[model samples]
Target chain A: MSQTVTKKLMLFFPKCECEKPIIYHLVKDHNLIVNIYRAKVTPEEEGYLVLDVTGTEQDIQRAMDFVRTFNVTINTTGKGVTWDEHRCTHCGQCLPRCPTKALHFADQATRQVVFDEAECIECLACIRVCPFNACASAF
Target chain B: MKTYEQINDRIESGKAVVLTADEIMDYVDKKGVAAAAQEVDVVTTATFGPMCSSGCFLNFGHSKPKIRMSEAWVEDVLVYAGIAAVDVYLGATQLRHGDPANMYYPGEFRYGGGHVIEDLVAGKTLQLFALSYGTDEYPRREIRTYFTIHDLNQAIMVNPRNCYQNYNVAVNDSDRTIYTYLGILEPGRKNATYCSAGQLSPLLNDPYYETIGVGTRVWLAGAQGHVYAEGTQHAGDCERTGNGVPMEGAGTLALTADMKQMRPEFVRGVSLRGYGVSLALGVGVPIPILNEEVLQRTCVRDRDILAPVVDYSVDYPQKTGRVIRYANYEELRSGEIEIEGKKVAVGSLSSYCKALEIANRLADEIRRGEFLVSRPIAPLPRHAKMKPLVIREK
Candidate 1:
């Protein structure tokens, strides 16, 4: 039985590394599903891609090792989505906009929209959908 | 049966038994309605949501040269300056000059009169520009100045229509998604959006504006206010149940409060992505326990209130009034409702937590002898029909 795992990651590409088809190699070679929420890979410019890489645990590890050869940096920090708790009114207006239940009510009692960074794929849907501007993009 | 004067006496003496609409249900469930009625003197209800009919009337202290302002713009958003020389009515949903509304297709609608209201209340400096066609008494033709909340003589929030008895559950059944004042509705009934506080709502508790009427003191955005009149388009004679709860948008109130005493957090500026800007304000009405019948009505549970599910993409906009189904607050709060045997998610635009906070605050104020409930000198209309407008050649 293959153990499937999905990792939320930010891949920082150096100026010299943007030319390579790194995402293509991950899909064609490692057979991973890369759902890119945001990408800024430009020629001669340092860029980053906030994405979700899903595949078997073994294949994802192999893909990470392959990307290391290009002098690219991999970070697991959830800094892409900026949410201010003070501004959140807990109206649940951002419920349907979220692909995942990243922003959802903690429980029926309080009915507050709590932020779960682990579940966030950096889709940034809650940023603009929130009428209160409680959610924003850090980038 | 108790009287409004009796309740006020109890409030003044610090002997009143005050509870929130949500809290009253527990009391009634424990002690029964008849017993609870004699013990509980008041029940406070509240709702906080986007009310587009809300706005503020401001009187800017006259300028040095004095200009009879015909046109005024605050933070690039136009304000109705026809009231007087320095007075302006800043509507909540008014867009900025050259807003390019929906031209961007799902426009961000970043700034508007709503944001300006929030900024002013937050004590931020705002630029005001006025134009006049040169008057003799007020000789200035144009003037540009900056002012803050303190600079204005008066900033009063006057909402012409607010606190609908009930609202529809918006759904989009079309192939494409639609953006509306109700928020974003997903295509093919993927999700539903509702905008009411349900059982804790003021009109739902009172049913027929029994205690919430003209001259009735209310908690308006953290300050005291009064119900001045019936709200615009108030269709009080809507479909109802045996419990007297309106099944659709019904009785409403025109409320006013001095914005100087209001907190900025209670009056928030909201920006719907594709739709225009609107203000989300907090309003709480105290329903005095005049009799056992009043106590029983205030004990309305979430299951008792039903909201009609209307498709915003077609039914609502086309005025066909097609209802897919009726779901109570219980089902809506459960986060899912069955549509065509498929479980579709649901959400609400109103903040139940904020409403609860306001209700609790009002209850505390009444308990501490700081707030008192009063009967209306003039009752709201019980049978007012909303009229539709049609273009005609007179």
Candidate 2:
């Protein structure tokens, strides 16, 4: 078995399994270390949880496969970032807020702001500074 | 020495050579100021930044009964009333009535007076409403309807203050980030942002106001405009560096331009997070190189224009002795600088790229004889002093 690895993920539970205590099973049965950063759950509706899970590579893969048996969707990506072209004024307001150089002016002549998703640390600083609410994230 | 008339004649005949402040520096460095003065007829300077005092006057066509508007709103943002019966001045910083009042974590300012003005200039129809007390002659109490910039009798942007000569650099020392009109300032001096475009700025190059004054034509928001008066908060008297540029805020311009000719690219709406709404305006002024002294003044470079970084977390004008020391625009634009043993990143409120575009475009207009240069009807006063307010115990 490989060494323990940590991964941040988002788990979505459909309405059919909203009442099931999947987190309890992950902790007791699987013996996985989990830290829930955010959770939104309702008795009769879909639910979501953002968590950091730590376990052996094989154990983590098995745990995710087991989650699929409950009809729950798991995404290992931390968060999703999207830019609304219609709303963004290309004013470059969010350029400085980004700690990483993921966002910058495209070139000298156009001076339009562009975002490179690969370089983004997903700190959401751009979302806060954007005056037009152009930068949005899915958590 | 070239006279204003001679320069005007040259411009009219398409013979006057124009260069940007940066280009002028190269010309002057290659040949001395005297020779450059003989070769270059004009040097252009420009700045593009958020100017809060920007606004426009709109004359809504007379209603059935002209209402002396006591209260006015454009797209839910309040505008200045008490002007003429039908005229209203829409200020850029005015927030909508529905906007959140929170200062720290206030949400985005999606739309406001600035957007409304921009929409009007773009030939879009906007809702205009006004309430007033009914009178004998003008008995209309309230009016609400859509008004386009074309339908309005007149639309003119007469900003009380536009271009600032040299502004301070903003930095934060607190543990938490602070959102200010200067933009988002990171905590622990992680970043520093300055406003002016340094040597490319018009007023900074003409530090003493020798050539720029009332009636001087400038490239305002991609349109031709003229300086009307000395701007509000005009600080002619201030400490200066050896180069004669003010170490603090100094001269400003009260400008006026027709709204019909403005381009949207040059007019941008900005929201300073916690602060309020403002308009990013592009302005370019041409300096006629009449003598070698004027040419030398216009040749100042980014390395020589120094500005002090100030802590904006505290109350301003009262937070004395908070300056970290002066840094030139060249250092500030380097993206990171060591200050007090810490590496602090840098940002800018003024767009150097846009300023360069405006300067080049203005030079092109002059070279093609499409734009006319005007002499100032009256020179700006040089002895004016800015005084600080003191709170005295009663």
Candidate 3:
């Protein structure tokens, strides 16, 4: 029997003020798992959050493309990327940027983008091309 | 203005006037006292916690051992009063000479830690004063002298007070004798236990120089602010005395007694500030100002007088650790000798030795002078015309 290895991915969001339930729903609706950590806040800088995830490389890439459909920025470290709301414009231009066809627009009533942390491969291709500067990596 | 040489000559001839407490008061009461007091730049106060009575007992696994404790005595008080500068001096000296191992441990044991003269001298330029007291048929005369360094580059005068009084004076080495001064500030009863000195953790462990997480309460009293801390002792607790007198249920008695001893006249006006240390690093030495220029130019680094001399090491914890120690004779002499490297000859080893000897003799001479009567007041004069001025401009 062959053993399968899963890569760990981490994501960070700087200065997030949204309630925990809303953040959980944004991730759960997309079937993604993430662990949150807080960063030290200095006088000159804003607060930030970090998330760790584990998934296959292909699944991670698929997840990155999927989160982009809702206009949420994403960057991957290991296999996951952060989505910052401050820089997010909710523009759907990045939906066509993902090659895996994982992203799709959600209901207009909900202003959140669906994200699967498990499906991020940390390729950083979508992050580099992100014009909003909302996406960042743990690294 | 007298030159340094003239002052040195007067001190050498035993012609320097020893200012009595009354004379000091009178001098200050005069118009020029502030200017005279300005000559005093450095005032070093060091608190020496009693040595651990259990010598090497903990190292040998003797956990619970009874130790004979000595009377907690105030070691020495160093004051840089005037005449440019003089070395620190003490009236009484007690020297314990024996095998270091038997006292501290086996083998050659050096008194390495708990002397912080360098830290005390960090920003101040002052001479080291060594004073010793003596008693004989000619009269109980305290001798004053100075130090003159020899080729050894360092001379450790063990218990300079005891050496001069008992050993040096007996050998008629008065010329080489260190000067002595009667204590202006006398040792009082050990009345208060602010907290056990042992309770203080080493300085390095404390990040903020504050005690952390220990539910110790501190009482801080400020002139413009209300009392910061107050508490009651447990009932039935007894107050311990320096003379071994113990009184039961003496709540707040310890502080009251200490206040009474420290200032008997104005006990009511004395205020106190106390706080608990989650981590205590002992008391800090106030920075010495060698001159007005030095006072104005010097900057505070790490809330200490001297900058870090060398990096902290476990062996040399005073330098490395947060806690600074008092400087011994050996350390001061070494520092004086090292000054030669800077191309400054304040005095030779013999000269230094003589300075201390002369200081001790001067102290004795001052003590022998006729005591003056009458209390002296501050020199600041109140002028009739020096009323509050109010100006009205059209």
Clashes of each: 0, 0, 66
> What lDDT tens digits, residue by residue, belong to model 3 across residues A1-139?
2232343433333334222342354356534565553333333444343455444445445666664453444444443366665443333223334344233234422212344555544455445433333466655
Q: Distance (Å) between predicted and true CA of B192, model 3?
A: 25
Complex DockQ per candidate: 0.64, 0.23, 0.00
Off by over 4 Å in 3: A1-31, A37-49, A69-71, A74-139, B1-394
Provide the lDDT at B360 for model 2. 92
RMSD each, Å: 3.2, 4.8, 30.7
Per-residue lDDT of model 3, residues B1-394, tens digit only? 2333443344455554443111232343463444643543221111111111101000001112211111111112222222111122111111212313324311221111111121111222222222323223222222222221221122111110000100000001122211111000011210101111010111111111122111211110100111111112212222222221111111110110111111111101100111000100111111122233322222111112111111122212232222222211222222121221331111101112112222233234323431111111221111112122367797
For each candidate, the alpha-carbon lDDT, in order, equals 0.89, 0.83, 0.24
Listing candidates in order, what is each one's chain A TM-score?
Answer: 0.79, 0.63, 0.38
CA error at residue A22 for candidate 2, angstroms? 11
lDDT tens digits, residue span A68-90, model 2: 99999988864656677655555
- Compared with the real two-chain complex, what DockQ does model 3 have? 0.00
Candidate 1, residues B302-350, lDDT tens digits: the string is 9999999999998888899789989999999888899879888887899
lDDT of 3 at B62: 10
At residue B234, candidate 2 shows an lDDT of 85
- Is 2 or 3 the stronger prediction by lDDT? 2
